[model samples]
Target: MPAKVGAVKVNNVGNSSVFNIGDVYSMSPESTAKTYAGGGSFITGDGIRIRLGQSTTYVTDKDKLDQNIT
Candidate 1:
């Protein structure tokens, strides 16, 4: 029952208790809302894959991408 507004969720495809997973909505899985598919560019759901947007690399002591996320 931990629902968050404007929270992005991956579809619980196989979960018998899952709601929806292809877009964005203002309410929780039980509420009436639509998914946000970047016009066939992105998909969110369990087992479903998506190409994430380009990542930005900041200058660290090393040239590797920062692994520490807050």
Candidate 2:
């Protein structure tokens, strides 16, 4: 019904983030990131050259009700 907060301090808040000091119904944070790195190359038998690269994906939420789909 009521909330009381004393001295508070915050350092930082990132994108798609939430900071609650009091009561709340709900909170959802979503984020997606992709990265790639390569240091080598390869050639196919058909004489086609291809570069090899490593990749990674990070997702906070695959499906969020706030956005419907992710």
Candidate 3:
């Protein structure tokens, strides 16, 4: 099983003006001391869904925004 390294929360309702449909985001832990990796997901109020892994590239539609952590 993958270890739980960190947690993330996406707040679209709080900043709806800056967020849009199909927007994607990713997050990871700050420390690399642990051998296992971590990831998370969330669905925004605008029907935008985001899925993330430890080390993966984020892609989205042309009209959407993509944010990821290296």
- Residue 25's lDDT in candidate 1: 54
Query: Any residue pairs clashing in model 2, and if so which?
Result: none
Which residue pairs in model 3 clash with each other? none
Which lDDT tens digits does candidate 1 get at residues 35-56? 3334434545778755556644
Q: Candidate 1: misplaced stretches above 4 Å?
A: 1-4, 20-70
Indicate which candidate wins on TM-score: 2
Candidate 2 lDDT by residue in tens digits, 1-70 = 8799999999998777889998888887777654343343222376565644664444465654443435
Task: Report the Cα lDDT for candidate 3.
Answer: 0.42
* Alpha-carbon runs more than 4 Å astray in model 2: 37-70
- Candidates 1 and 3 compared: the better one by lDDT is 1
- Residue 55 of model 1, lDDT score: 49
> How well does candidate 3 match the true structure in TM-score terms?
0.14
TM-score of each: 0.15, 0.44, 0.14
- Write model 3 residue lDDT over 1-35, tens digit each, in one string: 43454555565444223433343375333422213
